[model samples]
Target: QVTLLQTVVGAHDLFDVTVQLQPGGGIFQTFVRGSGDDFSVVVPDVTRVNKYGRSADCTSNNEIRPLCYCKSNLMPTSSPSSASKSTK
Candidate 1:
């Protein structure tokens, strides 16, 4: 099953979306924009690395790094309020 992961609307009404296939699937990233009255995939489907447990696989050179959600990002972070509530 293919799931729509993320969608970003850019200038000129362009839609940048990332779709992920279920069951050990790769990330398919593409861009869509309006063609007259109908919308279409303007760009080709680019398969990005599965950065689930291996965020290290994505480097600075990777153009899709900005669009990826690293597993580390899902980790809970200490909120400002929690950090401020320290023992006296």
Candidate 2:
């Protein structure tokens, strides 16, 4: 089973993320700009439920599950290294 080890919310128009895992040895990174009121969660290594961000839309009946929601409106950067650290 995969476990959610941590969550880091973005700030200052920057949503740079880096996730490190052990035993599973997984590493994921993604960057999202804070413009347009967008939010996203990215898990780089695998293409499972744990990799994508979920929305808070209650109408879809998906909100009851922790991983069901809207797709991010923000654009992803070409590289995680180019992402700026949020100041908040």
- The lDDT leader among the candidates is 1
The local distance difference test score of each candidate is 0.60, 0.42
Identify the candidate with maximal TM-score. 1
Candidate 1 global lDDT:
0.60
Worst 10 residues of 1 by lDDT: 1-10
Candidate 1 matches the true fold with a TM-score of 0.37
Candidate 1 lDDT over 14-87, as tens digits, reads 76666775433556677777646998887765656455445434456466653455555456899888888874
Give the clashing residue pairs of candidate 1, or none.
none
**Model 1 stretches astray by more than 4 angstroms:** 1-10, 35-37, 51-88
- Summarize candidate 2's per-residue lDDT along 1-88 as a digit string, tens digits: 2333333453565555545544223444555444566755443333223433333343456434333333332335455545544432
**CA shift of 28, model 1, Å:** 1.1
Error of 2 at 86 (Å): 57
Candidate 1's clash total is: 0
